[model samples]
Target chain A: MAAEPPYLELLESVDSFPHIDISKTPYIEDESSSFYQLLLPNDARCHGYIHPSVVHKLAWTASFQVSHSIPRTVQLLDDSDGKDTAAACSRAFYEVIEKAVDSKIYPFLKTMQWENYRIVGAKYPTVQLLRSAARLFGICSRGAHMTAYVRTNDGIKIWVGRRAAHLFTYPGKLDTTVAGGVRAEESPFECIVHEAAEEASIPADFVRANAKACGAITYVAKSSTAYGDDSSLMTPVILYNYDIELPEHIVPRPQDDEVEDFYLWDLEQVKQAMVNRAFKTNCAAVMMDFFIRHGIITDENEKDYLEILTRLHRKLPVPTSPSEA
Target chain B: MAAEPPYLELLESVDSFPHIDISKTPYIEDESSSFYQLLLPNDARCHGYIHPSVVHKLAWTASFQVSHSIPRTVQLLDDSDGKDTAAACSRAFYEVIEKAVDSKIYPFLKTMQWENYRIVGAKYPTVQLLRSAARLFGICSRGAHMTAYVRTNDGIKIWVGRRAAHLFTYPGKLDTTVAGGVRAEESPFECIVHEAAEEASIPADFVRANAKACGAITYVAKSSTAYGDDSSLMTPVILYNYDIELPEHIVPRPQDDEVEDFYLWDLEQVKQAMVNRAFKTNCAAVMMDFFIRHGIITDENEKDYLEILTRLHRKLPVPTSPSEA
Candidate 1:
């Protein structure tokens, strides 16, 4: 009989990434007694919760009332008149946040150039726009990330890269070949092509033709950006996944300084790196998801295969759309 | 802009399948005080729990020991030296059950043909095998199901079918295009191919070429098969999901009597059927999974989007694989 394929042999490893305890993480809820009542960016670890009253100071915080049914207690009302209030509050909220950053209250906000875009979610409607740095805090920002790999005679090798050391959050940690947040009005497919060109110097045409949709991963976990005595800020993220098969000769070059360097790493090396915490906290999720999907992690090797699979695909709290609301 | 897809328009309906409260279902556990102590197939609903001491009548019971960590209180031992004993016990157990079935212990089972298959799990090494009828009693079995759809110019439509009325379980209920349990030696993909041909009369070659691995759904809910004074069995299932796009020209004829008839139904019709209990309990899960994955079920339309998704993919009790055991 022919020998087992290289991918099948890789599944024999009994090692797995440390289980992530999502329950231990904080949540954004309506209850006033809940811990980590607000979200903060990774760089602004010292900033306390951006109290709803802060937005009230701008005279437009009426719609940010708490709701029991929704995970995020602070909701954006959907009534046409209430929508006007929400829109005004959003505009004022954006201005207040931008001014605070300019005043250096969130000192880490100075680290990168402002992308001049706003994030939105199904949980709430927003006309407010904030810089890229603070979008993930107290908001749902959908991002599209792609892992580019190549099929080789010996085995399948991933084109891995490292986050630049100077970056504030998870500096120098590993990342997928092409990863980026989806900006307003940008489709996931469109974002993948843009990130592919910007992050890995890959041609848009090649990525568009080769990428395969690999579903998505969702997580609500605590970040290190918590204020004192509070465990940390909790953030919710929905990452749409894709697999792009690169041609053997098309070596990836870093188009931006966001990534330090790229390397062609084997599946075992990637698996070991995941176990070693070399990858960014969330990037580790992406790698494990890919491995399990490709059947590199089986019931034979992973003690909690079912648990891991369930958590990997756990649905995050989605906002109700305006029309439906 | 192009006209809105028919599938998208179908999402306007807020109706959904009746909520399945799996947590409220009985469980089969080793603890003497456990609510549901055993599993009896659908047809044997009137027969309640089967006492293990009854197996001693055949003098083949040894390792049905109680354990703390294993799912079924009745554990299967994995000691290598005891292989012969376990094998003999397995053989005797098979014969005893067969004789009982042939003796009409389960009259409903007599309606179906017996495929020579025994269920095995990673949690314990098996020396003996039981007929397919009794596999769910105290052990875990994994099944693979496929939802095949065709792309229409008006939007995506699905090929749905009804289970034959003469079947013992869920007779005349609606079902996906094709679904089946994994045989002892067959892999999920191999089982899918076999089932596709057997149930839908789709060619083996078409299934092989078009199937896409969409992931799996896990559930461990109590079966409604209860006797006059006692509740029947509780079973756990991990169904691997697949989506195969069928070419418009090929019509599926029911090869096996398992499926009664096929229909080229629109999304709205399927959604209405789900809300009306037209599909079997588990098949409802398969359709909901398809809807959520394909983005037909949104947070706006489904008040409990997260709750529904969680229930659809609830984690099952996965036994430790034999090697690990």
Candidate 2:
């Protein structure tokens, strides 16, 4: 049998690959493209499809910043797709990565590496093929993705990063570190494991729990700062809640090329920071609520973050439409 | 375009033709034929890939005894396949029927005729094709050949029948009515609907809700008083809860050819009956519990049934056999 062409190899050879800028990557119009439109909850819209490289950039630039940015992006994504699709995408992403890692295309890589190298990096043919397959499956055919939540003694932390500045959407803003689109062949459990390792530098063995599935959300972006198009659509996403305990001393070092900085925040500080708008991204606001709800973080400061999250939670209505405004 | 081979003609012929006595039909399990085993939620085994006629027989018989016997069979079928698959099958079946009816295969059909005829008499090409497709797709599949469930005014009801004197497996004893080996291209929903119409003459529309998948269970049924062959195995069923409200004056009339008699009981009565040894099929006992937990039924009589269901639920161990135990 002839050896299959190495699609991943071809992708890795590129220099200055197109990356999604976490800050610049505008929320994707729900209808911009099926890719962006499909990964959200029903009440949310497509915030954007950040290039894999951008995720790595944010993780490396400032790990702590990711705490805020990633959650915000997720919220944006959820808002664009609607609540149902967002949750579905979340669950689906987690599951796909967990499965991809199990297949072992990239081993022992940190979450950031996994994102750019394995998922966004387009190093594996399976990932790319799965993306195409997902598109063909139509909205109803899409499977749930995966999401992981990790906490260490360094402080209550979530995996996040910034999109490469050069990318089309949200360039330089923080975003999910260990998150990625789910492949057709994998389950939520499989996707998250791969994403966690690839994006956050978390090892597969470090994962301790697979919690209940949080709901889904959707988001849709209008013609704006990025993508410069009128196309608007919804993206569906499923979210899963996972609990992981890390050594208090363990400092998550974002892959420098993919991330700009990393930070470890005390649960209270992070929560207070979110309330105080100390963080630049909505990702932080969203994740703070996730942590508090899951009981991963409990402090008076958390109350503020919790309140913001609750408001956002309520703000993102089910079956929402543009006309609702 | 040679007239589409009379697709509608074929369907009508099949429906109008005199019913076949599948009970007496000589059927030889095709050992050479490939089969798929799906794992369900209870300690019951469901054999998939049997002939469609057999499936009809099981469903029809079960539906006739909707009040008592059908529930048992549904329980056994549910136990055979995971809840997700079961639910998927139910949804798929309804969709196919809806589509077929929309296409107007049989015109001038009254609402009741539409529901009843479509439920029992509808032929599903997609479900028939699923067995092979599932394998190609790497999905674990199973067959719940002899089972059926109904939605009653009060809540979901499963039906089982006391097998006739001249039958195979569990002859002259209580068994599922609308269930049997699920054939290729037939989803659980279609299978049950078909069975219900044939056995109970119930309109499909009256079955407002479809099966609620709880999960699968596997058990071994050694040849006993029901069967002369010691080597033969029996795969009972587990089923989901569905609701179908009927006029207060309407009474379920079982087909004399298929069932000895039929009666309606509240959830508690059914549960109590099972616990007090008022019923013969273990499958029925288990289904009652599934109904209770899903909030399909509540009250003291149902509570007693739930207790028996709980006890039975605990007694059945995982099947020991590797293939179709």
Q: Which candidate number has the best lDDT?
A: 1
CAPRI tier for the interface of model 1:
incorrect
For model 2, give the interface RMSD.
Answer: 21.9
Per-residue lDDT of model 1, residues B1-325, tens digit only:
3222233222222112122222232333444323323321111111112233332222223434443332323343333364554454455556556665666654444554454334333322443344345433534556788888988987788989899999777889998898887665566778889999999999999888877766667665444432211233345567777788889888878999889999988887787776666777677777776776665664434554544555555544434133323
In model 2, how many backbone clashes occur? 225
DockQ of each: 0.16, 0.01
Number of the top TM-score candidate: 1
TM-score of each: 0.62, 0.27
Residue A174 local lDDT, model 1: 92
Q: lDDT tens digits, residues A144-244, model 2? A: 22233345545346544555565333456555444454554554446657666665666666642422233221211121212322222222222323334
Worst 10 residues of 2 chain B by lDDT: B116-125
